[model samples]
Target: MLMTTNEPAPAAVSDGMTEGESGALYRLMTWLSPSFPVGAFSYSSGIEWAVEAGDITDAASLRGWLAAMLTDGSGFCDSVLLAQSHRAVSDQDHAALSEVAELAAALAPSRERQLETTTQGRAFIDIARAAWSSPGLDAIIAACGGPIVYPVAVGLVSAAHRIRLAPSLHAFLHAVVSNWISAGSRLIPLGQTDSQRVLADLEPDVTATARRAAAASLDDLGSATFRADLASLRHETQYTRLFRS
Candidate 1:
């Protein structure tokens, strides 16, 4: 998962800039891959609760649930946090970084939600410091003097490595969606093909989410996914819960 000094920038990967995009592509895939070890498999972001409540009993319901997530829920907030974190890192603004982190931490609707984010965030930075050291990342580590949120952890690392923010954000969101899909597949007992089909249906929403998030400021941070938020809150006490959050 370590990106080499020789890796290309890959900013214009789609523009046919072959030289730099290879490294760029590699870094994006590595960070987003399930093998990165952030314990993503353990937390369902309340999807477990959604399943238990019968809100997501099948592919259609699951697709609708996930679509709102991408456009209106924590997805929107996390995307803004990620975008701002990357920008703060680029500008070397530790104060803004801290503010973003603090805001992100407090935005979680429940204790389990906070735990899911903080635990994963810390784990991401832990591996980042150990396996993918860099001056920019080092400064970010020193700045936090505490735990970083998951999106911020990723934003800073990508900024430090000179990975194009667009691709990095795209992959990050995609990874988030993929993990949810993986969870639903297990919970709903969805056939593999049906799961893939649901993911395919989400492509447009994912792109739109990224587009809107990149342009959003902190004031734009809000969640209209009340049911989803309530699900996370209730998930904290579910007696037969299978997920950590």
Candidate 2:
């Protein structure tokens, strides 16, 4: 997906900007897309346990479970971390970047959750560096020492590439919610149409959560969805499971 310099410059689109604002849009979609090789398909974020425990049995139930997560659980917390990490990188504040990176890893409620985030984080960095290398991206990576969580990696990359934070936040949250919906759809055995319906229904929630998180400070970082956190922990011991967490 690397754009060659020798190719002709992309033609501009009518939105007063080119496609996804001169390719920033395309980059965001590619990085967050389901096929990005982050192993996102393997992690259910605990939705598998929820299904086994009868917490999510249908599309509506799944919608409610994920709505709470987006608003109060890891979704919101991760968004905050991403927002702060983006700011830190934009400001070239290595200290702040490192702080959020550690916080993101520590906030994981369970070992599986930690693995889910950090494993994907490492993969994201490795792939992005190889395919989309840039001096700014490397600088952000160097500044963020210790464990790099998924959100932090996405945030820093967006910052390094000069992508606007608003769209980046929106795309990141949307991808998270979509992944959860996919997991629930499979666990509950919902039809594809039903799964799409659930995702469409949550559009408003996604937009609201992304907006709130983008403006939030690091001090606002926290998760209150105890049930979801417990679900993640329980997933570790479930004898039969389809997801990593």
Candidate 3:
């Protein structure tokens, strides 16, 4: 079993430091940085398979598919898991944390999706431990006997970095949407302008979804099923693919 290390608690904030101060911006940026070594760049989350199947071949279709995914698929499930993980870590409730971790691991729609999330999650946990040195994080790592799902890792780091749930959720959704759009632009051969337009249009939906997710509970963790899951499972055997997922 892999385990996180425990370090000293965060230092007390200096006088005059506001909760919304610019100092938080640096922490947020570092968390969302592409070079953070979480290895998020390698997974397409089965979008590549969708494109190959002609189910998502153009900008409009890609946007629609991604919107559905955000509102109904992994994004929703991940948000629920992240919120639960945040609460668990905040309260130091190890049993609840383990429950959330197990749910997150089981929520993956396909083998590749499972591997992608768990692999990146473990990597992210390791990176956070080495870079931030938080005691709470170390505890979570120590408890990680099973695969560390990505959303759990994200929540753990967000809590360690003192990022609030709302912005943290937004960042998580934005990262997923942005990565998929980046992959779609190349896979579907979408024009740069079109890709930008799709991203712009998605901003409102992403924000709304984040808000919805913030308010969701574990009981609400359900998906549309069939399309997303079937496509992902089929992607496993897709030939001549540009993506590993």
Q: State the C-alpha lDDT per candidate.
A: 0.84, 0.88, 0.79
lDDT of 1 by residue, 1-117 (tens): 222334544345475655455766776788789998999999999999999999999999999999998899988789989998888877789988888877887888889989998
Pick the winner on TM-score between candidates 1 and 3.
1
What lDDT is reached at residue 62 by model 1?
Answer: 92
Q: What is the clash count of model 3?
A: 7
Which has the better TM-score: candidate 2, or candidate 3? 2
Best by lDDT: 2
* lDDT order of candidates, top first: 2, 1, 3
As for lDDT, the candidate ahead, 2 or 3, is 2
Residue-wise lDDT of candidate 2 within 57-173, one digit each (tens)?
999999999999999889999999999998898788999999999888898889999999999999998898899887767777987888799999999988877777888888999
Q: Which stretch of 10 consecutive residues in model 1 shows the poorest summed lDDT?
A: 1-10
Estimate the TM-score for candidate 2. Answer: 0.93
Task: Provide the clash count, candidate 2.
Answer: 1
TM-score of each: 0.92, 0.93, 0.89
Superposed model 2: Cα runs more than 4 Å off: 1-15
Expressed as tens digits, the lDDT of each residue in 1-245 for candidate 3 is 01122433334356544433344556656766776788777778888888888998899999999888888888888888888887777677888888888888987878888888999888878877787776667777666557889888988777765567777788788888888888898899899999989989899888888888888889989998468788778888998777667
